[model samples]
Target: MGHADLVARLVEAGGLPGEWRSVFERVPRDAFVPDLVWDDDRRPVHRAREPGRWSGLVHRDAPVVTQLDDGAPDGVGYVSSSASMPSIVALMLDELDVAEGMRVLEIGTGTGWNAALLAARLGDGNVTTVEVDPVLAGLARARLARAGFRPAVVAADGMAGWPGHAPYDRVIATAAVRRVPYAWVAQTRPGGRIVTPFGTAFHNGTLLRLDVRDDGTASGRFGGDVGFMWTRSERTPHGSVEERVLPGHDHTESTTDLHPYEPVSDFDAGFAIGLRVPGMLATVVHDGAPADGRFTVYLMDPGSDSWASWRITPRPRGRYRVRQHGPRALFDELAAAYDWWRRIGRPAHDRFGLTVTPDGRQHLWTDTPDRVLDLVPDPGKERAG
Candidate 1:
C-alpha cells in the first residue's frame, strides 16, 4: 500500500490524530529504515533484492526490525532495535500529549523515525533523542539530517537520559523497562508527562503515562499494550532457566486445581500475575502433543535457584501435577496472585498505576493511592502510595 493509504488506515484506526497527520505524512519511514531490514518473521527483506516488498512492509502499520542482537554476528540473534509500528508510535505520542514548542526527551532513537516525527511536530530544537549504540545513534543522526531534520542525537546510555538538557516538558521511551528509571522522573519538569513501556521479567508490558510531581514522585495509569525491546543495560542474557541450575536446591511435589496456562493465557491476568510476583521468568513448553495434553509451564526466579514447573494434561477438569525447587514456592505464589486478581474483579491494565520515587522505590496501586498493592514490599515503606 502507498503512504497515503497507510496514513489513512492509521488515522481511521485512531492511531494518528488529526494534528499529527501532516507531520506523519512529511517524514517518510523509508528514509530512516535500513536497506537490509528484517520482516515480522525475522527474515531479511532487502530493499535491493525486492524493492516492492520492502516498500510494502515499510508503509504498512507494522514494526520493522532494524538491528539484531545489538548488531552482533549471526543470523538474527535477537531484535536489539526496531522501528515501532506506526499505530503504537501514534498511541504513545497521543499519551505523551506533546504540545507546540514543548521540549521533549526521547530515550531511544531506533531508526530516528520517531525523533523525526517529534521534531516535525515540536521543532528540531525542542526534541533531543539519545541512543546507547553509537552506530545506531550516528546512523539515525545522519538519516534525520538527510530527511531535512536535525534533532539533537546523543550517543550514550538512554537510561541515564540526556541530563545536559534537563527539565524537559515531556520524556518518551521507545524501549521497554522493568522499572520507570528515577533519572527520567528527575529530568522531567514537575507536572510533565513521561511515557514508557513498563514490562516485567515476563516480557509483557503496558504503555505507562507518568506525571512528575514536585515532591520527586511520578505516578500515572497504564495506557495501551506493548512489548518493546529492553534497553541495552537492562537486557538479560538469552537462555532457558533450565540451562542454569544450582547444586544445592530442594524439590517438592504437589498438585493444584489451577491449570498452568490459566494465568498466562490471558494478557490482563498475566500482567496482574507479573506485577504481583516480580523477578519471575515464565515460559510454556509444549510436549509436542497439545492433542495428548502434554504441556508444562516453567517459572524461574532470575535472582535465585527458585523454579517451579507445572505439567498439565489435555483434560480440562483435573488436578495438574506441580514440582517446585528452591526456597520460594513459585507455584503457590502464582496461585495467590491469581486469587488476588480474581478477588479484585480481574482489573484491567488501565485500573493499575505505578508510582516511582526519586530513590527508585516503585509502588503499584489500584485506582487510589491508599489502595496500594505490595508487589515487593520494602521494610521501611508503607503500602500507602
Candidate 2:
C-alpha cells in the first residue's frame, strides 16, 4: 500500500486519532530507520531509502527492526530496538490519550519515530524523550532534527525519567518492564496517564495504562497484548543452570485439577509462570522431535538452589497433561495462576489492571475478586529510569 493508503487504514483501524493521518502521511519512516536491519523473521535485509522500496516498508502494517542486538551489525543475540509495528504503536497512543499541547515523556527513544508522531500531535515543546545508549540517542536526535522536529532528547537512563521535565501530562515507555518504576508515577502530573508494556520475565508484553494519583499511587487496565525489548537494566540473562534444572524434594505432586488451566500458548504460559513464581527463571524447551511432540518448561531458582520442570504431553484429542518435577514445583505455580484465571472465568485483558506504588511495587488486579499481587523488586538493587 502507498503511504496515503497506509495512513488511511491506520485511521480506519481506530487506534490512532483522525488527526494523526496527516502526521503519518507527512513523516517519512525510512528517514529514522537504520540503513540495514532484520525483518520480523530475523532475516538480514537492508531497508534502503530508495523511494518506492523504502516507502513500502514504512507503509506495511508490521514493525521493522531498526537495531538488532543493541545496534550490532551481526544481528546476533536479541532485538533491542526497532521502529515499532504500526498497530502496536497506534494501540499505545490510544492508551496514552495524548492531547494537543499535552506534555509527554517517552522512555526508550528507539528510532525516534514514535517521538516524531507524538511531537506532531502534541507539538515539539510538549515532548521529552530519553534513550539510555549514547550512540542510539545521538542518532535519534540527529534524525529527529533532520526531520525538522525537535523534542528534548536526553541521553540518560530512561528508568530515572528526565526529572527536569517532571509533572508530564503523559509518560510512555517503548521498552518492556517487569515492574513499573516509581519515578514514572512520581513524574506524572496528578490524574495524568502512564503507559508501558508490563509483564514478567517469562511472558510476552501487555500494555498497561495507570492513572497517577497525588499519593504517588497509580491504577489502570491492561490495554492489549504487546511486545518490546526488555528495559536495559533488566535485559541481563540469568545464570546457574544446575540449581534451576534439577529436580528437588519440595516439588509439588501433579493433580488432576484443571480448574486453573487457561489456554495460553507455551511462550506466554512460560512467561506468566515465571512472573507468578518470583525468583524463578522459566524457559520453554522444544526438541523438534516427531511423534506426538512435547514441550517442556524449566524453572530455576538460584536462591533456593533448586530447579523444576513441567512437561506438557499433548494428546491426539487436543488435551494436555502437565507433569511436574524438581524441588521447586514450578508447574504448580503456573497451574495456580491458570486456576486463578479459570476462577475468574477467563476475564478479558481489559478486565485486568496494574497498580504501582511510590515504593516501586507493582500489583496486578482482576475485576472478579480484585486480588492484587505485589511485583516486588530484587533486594539491594536499584534500576535506572
Candidate 3:
C-alpha cells in the first residue's frame, strides 16, 4: 500500500536488513522518481495524469524505467535507465556491507535513489556516483538535491570510475559488464569490496562480489542472478535477426531430441552455456499459443554472419528440426555448451566464480580457481579451406 509498509514487508522477507531500515524509511523512493515513469512492461505512467497508478508502481518491489534510450521520445523507446527494484537495491547494499563514514563509489547514478540511500547511511560527502550521460547525471543530481541529499555526482563514463575521489572503501555498479574494469579495482582500497553485475555478450549474468587485493587483482563468486542494463560503452544493437538471415544463404537441416527451451529457460543452465560458449546470443520466438508449444530459437554470433534456428513443436517425445548456416554451426556450439553444463551437474549461480588478474586476464572457474573454463581456440576444428 504505502512505501513504509513495503519497506517493512521487505525487511521481514530479509530483503532489507535492520541496519538499513532507518535509511530506507528516511529516503523516500518517490522523491527520486520522475513525473513520468515506465513500468516493467515498458508502458509509461505519468504521475501528473495517473497519480494513483504511479504511486502504486513506485512503491512496488519492481524497477521503474525512468529514461528510455537515454531520455529520447520518452514513452516509447528502449529503456536506458531506471530506478532499480527496491528488493535488489537492498540485496546489493547488504552485500556491500557499508559502514558509517566509509567512502563509496557508485557506478550508474540512474534516478539517484541509490545515492540518496547511500548518503543517508554513510553521509552525503562519503558517496560519489558517476553517470555516463550528462542529461541523466544532471537529472539525478537535481533529484538527489531535491531529496535533501547531495553526493558528488559526476557526468562521465563509469568504467573509468572517479579517480579524483580515489581509494574508496567500496565500489558498486548498477550496470552489467562483461569484465570488471581494472580502474575500479585500482581505485578501491586494498581489502575493500567491489560489487557489480558481470555477464557475457549472451546477456545472462550474475552479480559478482570481489575483494580488492593489494596487487589490484579482484576475485570472487557470483553473488546472485541479476539483470541490469549494459554499460554504455558495451551496449550493442541486437534483436530478432530472422530478417537478416533471409533465405538461400547456406543451411543444413538436422534433428535433435533436446528441446529448444531447456538451456535458455533455466537460469543456471543458460548462464553456464553463456560462459562455456562465448560470443553467442540466444533468443526464442513463440508461435501461436504457448499451449500449442511451437517456437523457434535463434542463435547468432555477433563476430560473424553465422546463425542457427531450432524449430520446436508440441510432442511428448520426438526430434526437433534444426537449421544452421554460415561459418559456425551455432546449434552445434550451443549443444556442446549445454552438454558441458550437464556434465558438471547443472551447477547453480553460486557455484561459479570469476578472477580478474592485475594484467586483465579474466578467468571463469567452477567451485575452485584450479578448474577454469577454457576459452582457447581449437586448431583441431579449423576448417580446411
Q: Whole-model Cα lDDT per candidate?
A: 0.84, 0.71, 0.83
Error of 3 at 179 (Å): 1.0
lDDT of 3 by residue, 246-356 (tens): 788779999999886678888888877777666677777779877778888898775566789998887755789999998899899889988988897889878988877
Best by TM-score: 3
- Candidates 2 and 3, the one with greater TM-score: 3
Candidate 1 lDDT, 1-385, residue by residue in tens:
7778888899888778888899998988889999989887888899999999899889998899888978986843699989999999988888899889899999999999999999999999999999999999999999999999999999999888889998899999999887777999999999899999877665467888899999999998885679888877666555574574444566888888887565877778888887877666788888886676688888877555578888888666677888898778888988898999999898987898889988889888999766788676211111101
- Looking at candidate 3, the ten consecutive residues that score lowest on lDDT are 376-385
Query: In what order do the candidates fall by TM-score, top score first?
Result: 3, 1, 2
Q: For each candidate, give its TM-score against the true structure.
A: 0.92, 0.82, 0.93
**What C-alpha lDDT, on a 0 to 100 scale, does residue 202 get in candidate 2?**
49
Pull out the clashing pairs in model 1: 293-314
Q: CA lDDT of 5 in candidate 2?
A: 76
**Arrange candidates by lDDT, highest first: which order?**
1, 3, 2
